[model samples]
Target: MTSLTTTQRQIVESDLGQCITHEKLLGEGWSNTVSCINNKWVARFPHTPESTQVAVEKQFLYAFGKGSPINLPNLKQTEGNYCLYPLLDGKRLNLEEAAKLSHQEKQKACHQLGEFLSWLHTSSFTDENLSTAPYGEADFYQDLWQYVAEALPCDLRLKAEAYLDSYFTTVPDEERKPVICHGDLGLNNILWDNSNAISSIIDFTDLFLCDPAYDFNAFYSYFGQKWVNMMSETYTPHIGDHFWQRVTFNKLRKALFVVYYARHFGYESYIPGRIESIKESLSQQLI
Candidate 1:
């Protein structure tokens, strides 16, 4: 039994037919409400007011699905503005569970994640439908540097920019070139099952072709120093970019995005946490 807004019910029923029924609302998400529909599909609806960026996310899903380690729900029926996808196993991947995995399982998980990421960084994603990643390294720092050069009034943005400039001062622009990165690869976005293995991935709204450091740090940001050191040691040897250059470059760049997000679409309570993180980001300038 689908318990959706009358308009929503109409939309789903029209798309999938009345023979189908929605049952068990999985949960509401930041941008979409996900529910099990027709017993086999997951119907994701952008809440009222709609997420204009949902289309961009749909595009990212196509790319990510191509490289995912586990089975992912391909986009199925799209109605009104919402999309329907197959239901992945409804489970979450977290550190507590990651810790319990056997050594072999841990290695397998890391390998799968690394391979998924390698596909993104190495693939040439130039097509009429998808924009080619921007050219060269100067282009990488250009926006954030300009934002800082203009010296915006927002303390967080300005502070983040200042730290960015100092960090880039040492590393050459040519080394800061872009790579495809999972711009927001947090625990909540990844799905797993009781075996503590990755079942599927969700949320491509923050996907971007940018510095690979941004993706690598997700392990640190979501878990802690332990994972960070492990991943960095494994990944750094494979990277071509100046290490610190990419680190600070993407950290502050992403931080700037955070402020931009907080100012507009985010909740009031989010400001303080973002502000604190911004300050912390500024303070970590060793390069």
Candidate 2:
């Protein structure tokens, strides 16, 4: 049996004629509560106001799905605050499962993912449905710094502040060319098949237009610089000379957010690892 709020229960019951079975919670993300119904359909309910981006995400899927190099979810149903789709095939990979793959397999996956990102970043698709936040790279960094200031230890917070100051000076707004970002393209959002190949990418709630290097922060977080460089080599001319610097800055931003919100966000278990990753990312910075 699966647990659902009255709203979710009513929606599912109404859609499936009260014969729905095998309901189980899949997971909760920053903005949505997701669950499976009868092992066939996945239902997502907005956990926060931000989750309402589902409607726009659906439009992106429709606009880009046909020519997408990698698999993406197909919109199946939408009702009020709930959105439904067929459960995509394959399983999400954890770090341990990903490490089990041979180097060649990992490289192959990067190549494939690189190709997918290139297609995504270079897409000409535009819409009034997407976010129109009037922020550049510096503004975004400032936002992250403000959030992390209270969360991180004094020493780490100071270091992060210095990093941001230096980054803003060295990499100015003129160098930034905004591209569509998969906002939260981390390990959890990626699905892998039996052969360790990418099956599909999910979760578009954080989709926004920002520096293309912002997307590579996930590579540093999940697979480190080696794979990041490998993927970059295949991603083409889009990655710039200061790409690593950009990636490092973005990684710091993410680490700070997790550190600040861990307990409050119900992810206390993830704090230690996230802090360590922040340290490592800071150490690797070329600045």
TM-score of each: 0.73, 0.83
TM match of model 2 to true structure: 0.83
Clashes of each: 0, 0
TM-score of 1: 0.73
Candidate 1 residue-wise lDDT at 221: 52
Taking the tens digit of each residue's C-alpha lDDT, what string does model 1 give over 1-287? 44467777777777776645547687776456777876787777775445444565566565656565556568864636776777777577567776677876666566556656666566554333232232112343553244333433466556655655666686665555556565676677777666666677676555456657777665655554455444454352366547645654555666656545444445546756765665565556532
Report the backbone clash tally of model 2: 0
The candidate that wins on lDDT is 2
Candidate 1: regions farther than 4 A off: 1-3, 47-52, 59-67, 77-79, 99-104, 126-162, 224-238, 284-287
lDDT of 2 by residue, 109-209 (tens): 88887888898888786666566342222345454456545555677667767877788889867456777878888788898888889989888776777
